[model samples]
Target: MDKDWIAYSECVWQCRSNNESSHQTIGSSQAFSVNMASMNEPASTTASTTHQSQTEARTTSSMPNITQHSLDHNPDIFTIICCNDSFQIALDHSTIATLLRVCKRVRPLLSSKVPRFHSWWRNVGLWRPNGSLRFALTPSEQIALSLHCEYEGIADRSWLDNQADQGNATALFFLAWIHQIDLDSQQSVNKPKREAICQQIIFYLEKAAQADHPMAQYDLAGCYRNGLGVDQDPTKAVDMFRSLAECGIPQAQVALGGCYENGEGVDQDYDTAIEWYSKAADQGSEDGRLHIVFLRGWFSFIGHGVEQSDADAFNRWHEVSTNSTNPVLKPIATHMVGWMHYLGRGTVQDKPKGVNIIRENRSDEFPLGESESLAANWADINSDSPALRKFLGMCQFGSDHEWLCKHLVAVCLIHGFGTRQDQEKAAGIFEQLANEGHSVSQLWIGRCYSFGKGVSKNDEKAFEWWSKSANQGNSYGQWMVGCCYYSEYGVTRDHTEATEWFRKSAELGNRYGQNMLGDCYKNGCGVTKDIDTAVFWLRKAAEQGFENAIYKLRQLDQWL
Candidate 1:
């Protein structure tokens, strides 16, 4: 076999020691290359056939006349090479070299026929005993594979399309990644546009997945689960996830574990979920390890899956809050840890340390959804009256947002979280903070006057307070002001003024503002009736998990 084809052959690409912990990087004289005893001739065990086959190979190699005519005439050759089942995948270099010599002959046909590329990779890809690699890379593949730069969408679509047209599996996978999936788990396109992009993504993913691309398989399963580009099929998602999980893909393992955990397409089996999570954790996946800890915590916290143990829950939550590499759940975990510490549920009681930990999380750095902060009204407070009073005093001294910290105590008083219901006390705190020039407190006092929660129902006062906060550039206050103008709740209905306030608040990244702005655009309340603009604003808020925005986007989908 000639050196050029031999150098790029899958024998060198896939051959590795059974015990190899990593990929066998290609070299001129590595495992498969060692079969070449001389510069011109490859050493082979089948000595009788080697000389004659090499002679015939050199003759065939010189003739680049492979075309439709050749393919039509050589039907037997097509069946032998084109069929994935026919591939024996011999370990020796001579067989691979000869196969490449054949591929070289059929290069013109294979370039346009994408299916042949799929069959080629499936037949030639290695199955390591350790299951470390999905497919061993050729040097060109290694360079092409680095194109997945999340920050830079696609530097050159034509270049990648060229590679994909030439039947490059890596290129197909990247093309899929680029088309529909955004880095932040938000699609850049609105629903109508996303549907089209999702089709393109699924097309490329299927081609690459047919070639045994692991990431493509994982993504395709995600599509099935969420119905991104297709119908929701939990069975298909679970099936695909199980295949990759068995092949030691950590993300797939975690996904499979979740399927078992939640009984999505399978019977609920906590033990099985734990096993899968453990396997992923063993492979050094941070999310996998966290899942294991969380499962144990959940069991103890809920007292259903395993014997109840507050100590176990506290320890696991502590580990997640203090030591986990994944930041996704740290804020929630820290709060739980602090609450338990203060209550002396598991460890020795340390009120000061618990207070300190809770206070530390009051910073803007914590992951804040539309609601759910330490000061937010809906926090699951189980602490008693004495403990609540201590929290109230501690809240007053917190370094971040003094008014918000005090608002927590007010919410506790109103809700009777651990004290008697007292709206008067809550309204007193709101009025005092509003007088102190706190924008959020002004918004709260406005709500009190509008709803008559703790103050006399007064629309004029509500609008006045809302205006004061809006003038200070508070996003929530701005949204409230827009609402009053739009609905004539506390002011004369004025769509133009409402639109301006919504625009200002929406630009500041408030979900409520975004949803309202979309509403204005949808009905042409102030802005022009533009469905595209409405969907754009609504989708932005929906991606941030706003329920109202999500509902609006669903309503808009019927038009498309």
Candidate 2:
């Protein structure tokens, strides 16, 4: 018989149990005998079934010749047949039932021969409800499938432990990952439990690393570097990072660059660091790009690894300010940009615009006003040291609280509190805040301009800021405006304007304002000459211990 006919005959015989008894056999007994003879005959002669069944006894005698031993002894013939695509397709449910019915010996032999049957099932997208391909199989069969499938349901701790005990590298790596995740999640775990978990993670990670798992190698190196369940070994960490960097892992490249930059485990080499950082940046690593920018800027600024160039520093900072998405770095970069602009370092000096940019980008939270009780006890709180207030203010600044932080920083700059006194910086900060509508800052800015503490003395600027503060109803600002008018500091000497501002300040109970108003009345500079009104204002100032007012009153009393 032809090989195709024999395979078809075997399928029909095996599938006999699936059909009604009437449809069990595919052809007459004579045809089966003739086909069986054709298997043994030479290629030249064809076995004719029509007259072969004339003797029923001879046809029945050929049935026992097709035994299991005949097929099993020449198993390669069956193997070739079964390995065919058509054979596999035909070996479905009904065919399997038929094969079992035709000969029980064939089933066990096929099972032994085709050990990857479950793998084939998986390859064909067959999945059980439990995610195991061997759903209908016994526990032993499931275990056999698990060895090859690596299914998620089969990856419990117990199974992984067993596999790891048997030296399965993949199982060891997965076990390490599981333990690491557990340790990270249970922060409040007991010390002993945490240490135990860490040790297990290290043990498995090391085993997997030895097995050449790249992620395990990276993680194990980190453990060594940090002394987590391992001795601190910077050399080993550097070696691992170097290996992975050669493999083009971006994170490893960055780590290797850091090692070169800091001389942690090797000689410090700026060229090597830059090379590795560039490699990581090419791979789209943000930290790599940031480090490159920072390193280049620092080197350019100090002429260390590169020639000093403020323009290069400015370009790097400008890029960070404009393009970086990091919240903290962006603001810091913006501040640097403003500083460069103000100092004319690689940029034209534009103090007003520079200060404005810094003020706008700086933090917005006002920490000082957050607590009313704290504000009430400010004097007592700051009595310990002159620098205490400055330190507290910088803490707020570092925490991105801008309003009170700027005020305190300016105060520090003015008084050399906890830092070098920089009158120009102080004045700039005050001016920025003043423009932002801070009444107190406006008063300070006016004072700075009036006294030339930082910038050259400019009386008109002083009056302008003081006038803004006064309009905001600041009593000190009103008094300063009066002083400006009285001294013709910015505006023309206008005693009437001075008296009006002094009266406004006096009504608000400012001692200096009361004294100034008394003087205006006594001299008839603005108000009508009225000794009684002058005496009233002077007494008010005297109550507040204004010595000039008291001395003026003593002279007036002696004259009276």
Candidate 3:
């Protein structure tokens, strides 16, 4: 055999042995293999035959004359080289060089037909037993490979720094990521160190971004958007995202859509947002699909971008309700679909189906109370359920015993359930009910003021309303009153008063109040420090599946 073929055969044999040993060491691994006629060749071949083969290889090396014919006629050989283990082994510089010398047709094919080879090498590393092949690697490639290997073992960070200093964009990006991780993990007490790391991260990220490293551009855009280690600049963030979106990056497409939708750095354009969202969805992004469904429903229902079409709204919401894998979004879409059915907006009226959907998706595990039952009955009547209306006499004017219909109407206005959303009207109704001594209405009035839903946000007003409901023995109101005192929201910070209110709420079986009361006991906030009392209340809340209480109890157990 010729020297070039001999070298190629030796390299292939070495690679095969290494692969077998690696599989054995890792315990059941699979690797592709190449079948070569050279492997079965005799130990001896005349120099004349070797020379003849070399001449033939040279004559066939001409790309236009040989490559197309080989690809057309010898498709199996091309498939074996590209799809089999030979492609992987040829990634090694020595093997590829020898292969090129033996068969020049491979050079143009590899260069033109498989542009993804370099990216695959960079991401997955070369398939050598000793890890990545180092021959012919640029400084950035070296730093990237080293950082990639750090998941398996420790890496030399100083070498990465040296590579970055040598103007390696990838090394700079990698170093920035490392420093960002360090800053995240460092304690608040290490302020100077954290600040230094943050500055270094920003510097390296900016340098790498300017060099057009995709990840660096994405990360730097985020920093600009959030004012994290950089001046907040929505325009810059939009520009970066647009650049990446043009390159067909799905995440960048999503961000660009959000920017357009919110008018952050561009005009608010729901049509543009939908267009970008559709692009991302075409790339098989679940989030993109969800965004498209939501935007379509909102635009159709509100007549914002597209023409208002109840049928379109129903179709979009139905798609999400039935097909979405996101737990949070699925329930929301289901509720919207149920609302449409209940109101007979786009589909036939189906009150039973609507009610069943709401019941199944209700977040609270507790059975519906009398008030909830009354509200459900009111909804049935509102949906024009003839049997329910007759049975409850709800069709008659002024037949709303206990003000259930009025309360349900207010809730509908507040949430836009069956009526146009009007927070002001909801708040007015709630205030009237509060004046009539309805504890739940008092609590809702407090929430409205606290969040400025319909009235000017006033912590003092919120506290006053909460106190009224608390005096009427509302557990949630009592808990809110305790929180007000604890946080000094609308009153002086008084731990004793906070604890008293928490105790009252906890006694009424409020899990949040129970957790707070336990914390107060543990920390000696209002009452004397008592570990047993703390554990008692914490266990009560934890048993009710309060996540905070469960975590606190676990911490206390560790202390014990």
lDDT (C-alpha, whole model) for all candidates: 0.61, 0.61, 0.61
lDDT of 1 at 335: 66
Top-TM-score structure, candidate number: 3
Summing lDDT over every window of 10 consecutive residues in candidate 1, give the lowest-scoring window: 31-40
Q: Is candidate 1 or candidate 2 better by TM-score?
A: 1
For model 2, the superposed segments whose C-alpha errors exceed 4 Å read 1-171, 281-289, 307-311, 314-560
Residue-level lDDT tens digits of model 2 in 1-560: 25644854564554443333323354322222222221222222122343233322333322332345336556666555544445443443223323433443334443442335444444434445665532123222222223433334232346447767866555576667657766766769999999899888999988866654455677788777657898888899999888777766666787898778767678878789989989999966786787678667555554555676889978887887787765444555566677577557878876445545654563422112111111111111222132233243333333243354466567556655445668898889878889899786788888888879888899899899999988987666898899888999899999899999999988876667898999999889888998899999989878766689999999898222
Residues 129-197, candidate 3, lDDT per residue (tens digit)?
Answer: 544332233222332333323323223466556767866666687678667655655567376776677
* Root-mean-square deviation of every model: 19.0, 25.2, 17.5
Weakest 10 consecutive residues of candidate 3 by summed lDDT: 31-40
Clashing pairs in model 2, backbone N/Cα/C closer than 3 A: 1-38, 1-39, 14-98, 14-99, 15-98
The alpha-carbon deviation from the true structure for residue 212 of candidate 2, after best TM-score superposition, in angstroms, is 0.2
Model 1 bad stretches (over 4 Å): 1-141, 144-154, 180-190, 305-307, 325-332, 341-373, 377-560
